[model samples]
Target: MFEPSRIKNFVFVQKIIKSELMYLQKISLANFKSYEYESYVFSERVNCVVGENGIGKTNLLDAIYFLALTKSSISNQDALSINHEAEYMMIEGSFEIGESGENITPITNNQSLITISIQRGQKKAVLRDKKAYERISEHIGKFPVVMLSPNDTDVIRDGSEERRKFFDGVMAQLDSEYLENLLQYNRLLLQRNSLLKQFSERNYVDDLLLDIYSDPLVEVAVKIHQAREQFVTQFLPLFKKHYATLSDAREEVEMIYESEVGAENFTQIFRKNRPRDLAAQRTTMGIHKDDFAFEINGFTLRKFGSQGQQKSFVIALKLAQFEMLSQQKGFPPILLLDDIFDKLDDRRIQQLITMMVDGTFSQVFITDARPERTRQLLDNLGVEVKYFEIVK
Candidate 1:
């Protein structure tokens, strides 16, 4: 027999005890990027990596990103992530994941050790808890991360491919089925394009083989497109909400999902586009051809938006990404901010700091070239922050 007040208190305490806690606890880098060898133990909440320009601040953050995503965030070539004089690069991170209570000691079995290494002329290897994963894709969403960097401008400045990648990346972390379907679609598209090239070079067309390749492509393309549509439907509101918060409702931002196969039968679209694809010797339609058109006040953001507006737009997009991943994964993703303060205004920085203090974010890694500026900005926050300075 328990009093109602006591029962309420017990439930509240239990809720706090059961809250999920996930964060990177430590990282070690060997021959990775600019680091020959380095190890770091991180605070569970906020970590600030400070250094002079070219002193490897971004490299350290990239190491953490590599550990989470099993790849480099900035470089397309894995070899480029290795130190100039080194033949191999390795990054490892220890993550603590489980419940934490105020007084009770949490169980120790929640720690996950993830390791990634790449040797010259060899494929990258990824392992978790001393067990190698059969496929690296299996590790993607397990340790979710959201990165806001200077390069994020590409989402606004670049062409449709970049926008597709932005959305696809978010969907990949949230829905594994979307990733599998996307991968299959890409592989099928590659084969179909290769077949198209062969047909073009030989000046011949095989309807049977083309149809055989197109059938599976259309099937997978439908799934991928449907997933993208559903994702956008859910993602748009989040984006808008963050944009309004960041911009104070001064401007209207919109994103329209543009797909060539919209509302049309996929098989017919494939058949109709086969002749053109044969002429082009590449894929001309399908999920790969999808793009998100970003606009402000019904005009193109890329062409009409001011630089400040562009920056805010991308920030909102990332915050929305952070929100969506947090909701779907049941915990906030680790945030990596690389030289982002230099690109954003003071207001936006304050907004981010407020979120940090409010616990909207769990673990965050920030890199800055100016040590004093970084310290000055964060020193007054009164939150637990660990600062690591890089020295050449």
Candidate 2:
């Protein structure tokens, strides 16, 4: 049997193992959710945080989610959830990753910081880091992450909006330029929509609107479409492979992009749809309108899938996303599973844990409602793992 001190030293080494680890280094939260002022240093490999409900287990994951892209996992929520009496919320984290034959400093010395703050009742956002002058896009490709939670099941059970968000978030994290263009495209889309509303009321059209909006809209819309298509193209093979691995079958899985009016000749399509859009008072085409259809055996799984199938598909999608990010971006994104065991049976859970431990993930953060179940499953693994219990 291993000595207690030896085990303690081993855990300490694992916590700071910057080499060969391409995942989360640490996470710091301030006035964010239930965490008034808390920071957690992560094991470069596998880390677990256990807590009772409402103790901020999911909130911890949300903090990382926010740090990655400055957005929440769920869109409909208050921005000022830092604390009841707080004026702003903040989250900071570091990543130990390598890119293009160069290691990204390897979490040595002080961590590279990512700070996000939202002032009370402010719609705009602000981001800063070690240096005062830094563009938000610079943080991309540094520390990439992917999240899996109960809400992921909504991609299958709910409307297409959630699924679209799933794709957009993944793609955005991988390609920062795509994200920049997407933001520009969206701003123009909103302005055009507002103008369309005015046009419907017979308001005058400024000549600059076409020059200012249409050209950039077309250019940015094309870039967004290309990035999404490339992501989907690269994502599908691994996605299907993971599905087969998870289900232990070759049940064919398919993902098709559905776009309203800009499937071909994006610029011409936008121009052609302009009159109808003005009449409808909404910009009804482009990347914002695209959706992914997860089909199995030539039938749409969103409607026809059994509960087990849906869960397996979601897990496979997440794993495939992780793989794609690893291959294209040179580091696997961090994986977080929230009470996933509750939705899966022992056999499925065993299969998932096996994949997780067998190099499928670089670093994993898991939460289980029942510690007994989590402990029992983890005990079967031979690799090093850390467990922390959160009370209150």
Candidate 3:
């Protein structure tokens, strides 16, 4: 049973987790869209960002996401959101992380200040011990984080890109090499598709086309397929276990990696589809055509599940992601819930609080339209959670 007040008690009861978050430290925003000048410093544990709709609650989290991923959470909407007077924008933050070095001892009171800034579409980040960088990537990974916003429920309702991005982004936080590989693969994919389209126009000879385009595309496609399959294999069980916990075994969930190309015999599939590919002017059979089919019992959620069931499923996927990242990287990711409580019933809300109140997450940031309703729920958990109100 997760007792809310026990969060503070849990902190006192257990040895201090140095790798766990110490605090948010401080945030400085300038000319960053709606947040012309905004600053915030967070509690060492749980800090909730509360406000009415359109008052910059989501924007605050968007700033954090931008720092972490180097991209805005709300994609195309960014250009319009940029402040009128600001040619380029910036958001800066400083924080602390546990020590890592030749010291064999545990990280007791071990921490360092980190500084990160995003300006002119470039990210300048560093983690320092008063003066020098302990490690740059260390700052990014050491403070592993995850954000679950209202928009995330679309993972169940939207295209495969959303679901794939969820996995890739989480994996990117833990594996820098994978991030590099994914970027390289995507770049090659775009070039190869362009060449293939040109080939259909009779602009390139067959041997030349095969030499320049086919082999490299297959190689990258195979690597991506294998990596995604391996990740999904390990991740699906964790997802199922979490779903069971949240839904109390009321639903059985399944995930199938559906790919039009890049199977074990993907070469044959590509060759067989070449005539059609030439007509379509693109190589359509590959990991790019893959989708994850999420099903409950025998019915597919995309076509059959009710809105409530779909939300529960997506939340379970997020919780599973949190656990997987923790297991992979040796610490739980910070959980962000933005307006998730809106349509949830009390029972489901209680279940969610049960998971978090015990400090399962190193830290959490949540937002809502009704601050008092959220505050009352937290009060029931007996936790001294912090809250902030955003004003336009």
Top lDDT model? 1
lDDT of 2 by residue, 1-392 (tens): 22343123123222223233466678778888778888888776567778787787877777877776666765555564667778887777775554322222344343456667766777525344555434656665566777778767788777778788788777777777887887788899888787878877876556466557777877787787777777888888878876776666757778898765345666777787776786688877767777888888889898888788888899888877776676665456677777788777776777657655545456788887678878888866665577767778
* lDDT score, candidate 2, position 327: 65
Per model, how many backbone clashes are there?
A: 0, 1, 5
User: In model 1, what are the clashing residue pairs, if there are any?
Assistant: none
Instruction: Tell me how far the alpha carbon of residue 97 in candidate 3 is from the true structure, in angstroms, after superposition.
Output: 2.0
Q: Pick the candidate with the highest TM-score.
A: 1
Segments in model 3 whose C-alpha atoms lie over 4 Å from true places: 1-23, 76-81, 99-142, 201-206, 260-262, 380-384
Model 3, range 54-87, lDDT digits (tens) per residue?
Answer: 9988888777766555457777444544567775
On the 0 to 100 scale, the lDDT of residue 88 in model 3 is 56
From the highest TM-score down, the ranking of the candidates is 1, 2, 3
- Candidate 2's TM-score: 0.85
RMSD of each: 5.5, 6.3, 5.0
